[model samples]
Target: MADFTTFLHFPISRCGIHVHESCYGGLPVADPEETRWFCEPCQYGLIEPPHCEFCPSRFGAFKRADISGRWAHAVCSLYTHGVTWSQEHTTTGVSWENLENSVFGRRVCTACSDKIEARFGVASRCESGMCKEYMHVTCAQKLGLLVDETDESDDVIVAVPRYFFCKKHTNQENLKTFQRRFEQWEKAEGRRITVHRRKKALSGAEDALRIQMRETLEETIREEDRGKSNGSVAGGEKIKQARLLNSSTEFFDRFETKAEDSGLSKKEFRDPFYDIKLTNASHVPIGFSKEYIE
Candidate 1:
């Protein structure tokens, strides 16, 4: 469902790997060759993997545009405060604008119990809204924090992991909250199903009644017509037929009037569960293997 038309990509001519727009923006600019765009690993001609300046891990790393020969993870750059990218679409710049006063250097990581020094990755706060806990991105990942990959806009190409929450909030608290919501949803769904069944039963009864009324009216007409064809219908018989026909008409009219007065056709029942979203149930806690959880 993502619109990929607006997502810009830079293809490495040498390796044929296409980099995301945000990743390419932080990478060093290529040489002035018409068909020569190379990624950091290909350009630098390194056999070993490049280390991320922000984290100890070498995975998901890109060369920093501001600092020559320095690398950082795209997720780290996004979550870290004071980190900024170039405004122009074609420019390459990811700078630590004012990192001295940033929380990365000030706050101690809760997971590793160490201050996140400069060039050793940035600190990311717990996303529980009120928790003052901070952790390095790698530490957060190792400690079962929820890092949700989200695409907020089509204008930006890179899908960043925006949502972060500690294990307590993600596993325990959110599980309890979701269980409560699910119970409520089940009750509401039961009520809606009951209402639907009752409505269907009522409609079936109405149809049955209408069919009976129509059959009765048709029988009356047939009997009257047979009497007329036989020429044996008396005045009394004629009067009885007329009364039966009038009664049937009045009954149908009364049924229609009652249905209109009940406003059954004017309103509809709306389910409260239609708009209820259970977002907490969808997110899986990080740092845990699926096999282990199972």
Candidate 2:
């Protein structure tokens, strides 16, 4: 079982209760139960002790950049570098230090298999509160797991909550798992709401429950709309307007009469344009010669 308050431990630790049973470990610990003994120095200097920052694997030949000060697997490094972090950073409004301390230190996203960067990426641990599995914002979107955050109010723009549900929760038997996930999501969102309230002083009108209910209602309406006939009441009205505009011969006749009264030919009305001829300046004025004629 995982605690809802404390950050999730790395996923690799979920393999077995006894850490020594982990096959990925380079060396076995004297006391498998204790965290301190999990990463005892290996006999061979070839495999160093520290866990790779990017993946749940032991490092062989790794890369360490000054920005993160941590070693990561070659593939993980490549993947992390490829991610566009700037947009996410701006949206989350999370400081690098808070991200580092609370979210990213030992965590790796199960979706991308890349080391979660505190400064660059936004991620959430599995809401199941069982495994240490995590998902990146982009990966969740790609999977269609993320909720549509757009709404008429600033609530969506200001504080879009990201919730993560583990794969196990897909079945009805895992109702407890689902409940745990929701509880965790609410717990996390509570802190976000506090910050939002302080910054904008949002009233109780848009409570967490209201926002959730509104989203549910909106989703239901969308589904209902989709189920209806393609030619909806609104769609039919639009078609009628288009047909009226197309078939109104009297209106066209009136327009043509106006055009004729304005001295515009049908062809000219369709493609009205002017042709100008360039001429050199004349010394004499128009309708008058250089000297007045007798």
Candidate 3:
């Protein structure tokens, strides 16, 4: 008989695949056939005949599809889910929580329909007030176009904004000037307060982002440096490591000392009381030699 296991942990499976007694406050696992589920989405029954929106696959009980009613390939769905796969490369992991609010309508590249939601390549956007097109960062640079720069100093490759443009829509000359000035401003403001880094030469509406970037860069650099220092070898870390090693050595030495003082070889060190007979309180030993007691 088909069981609830048919849906567990499968993509598009609405139910948890593997469960534990600790999952629900130490609740016991109920029989899958006997347990009654009330949630409309939880019941492992086909609500409607399945038709994949992305491909010509026919859906069944075992085949998982998204619960959102859109059954595209996992790759296609990832693009609509927003936050590019490239982000997982620069950052730690990928999450689908932001998919519902994704600005990208689909996972296909805005320039080319190739899948951009996978971890295989990089992607970017235009930061102009308008235009939400997607393109590869290298693609932008290859055409001598400017991509967004970060206020983040430690972010090896600065990430482009979510809403970026391609070279076709942006002016190269203006963008080049902006990039040059941005670099200059960053070097001058290396690790100082934003107010102290403010440049009179950049006092204009267009340069407003430059001022804001200074503040953001300052904060980001400060935070990263603070975190690094806290986790680095300079912050008493070596002392702590030495202390831990010393403590472990002391512990092992004490164990060895106890073993040596016990006066029993490894083969002779069996539990002596494991099979002893005990009839009453009087059966217990009342006295022992001082050497044996010690």
lDDT scores of the candidates, listed in order: 0.42, 0.32, 0.30
Per-residue CA lDDT of model 3 for 265-293, tens digit only, reads: 53343233222222122333434521111
Q: lDDT tens string, model 2, 139-251?
A: 43233344323232443333234354555443234445545664565564455434433443224632333344334433433433334436464532211111111012223
lDDT of 1 by residue, 181-294 (tens): 445644654554344334322245434433443344334434444544485544312221111111121232344356567774412211221232222222323233321111
**Models sorted by TM-score, best on top:** 1, 2, 3
Task: List CA RMSD, all candidates.
Answer: 34.3, 30.8, 30.6
Model 3 is weakest, by summed lDDT over 10 consecutive residues, at 20-29
Question: Which structure is stronger by lDDT: 2 or 3?
Answer: 2
Best by lDDT: 1
Q: Is candidate 1 or candidate 3 better by TM-score?
A: 1
Question: How far in Å is the alpha carbon of 245 misplaced in model 2?
Answer: 66
* C-alpha TM-scores of all predictions: 0.40, 0.23, 0.21
Candidate 3: which stretches are off by over 4 Å? 1-90, 101-110, 113-125, 132-138, 141-146, 151-163, 173-294
Model 2 residue pairs with clashes: none
lDDT of 1 at 160: 55
Residue 150, candidate 3: C-alpha displacement in angstroms:
2.7
Which pairs of residues clash in candidate 1, taking residues 3 or more apart in a chain or in different chains?
Answer: 54-121
Q: How high a TM-score does candidate 1 get?
A: 0.40
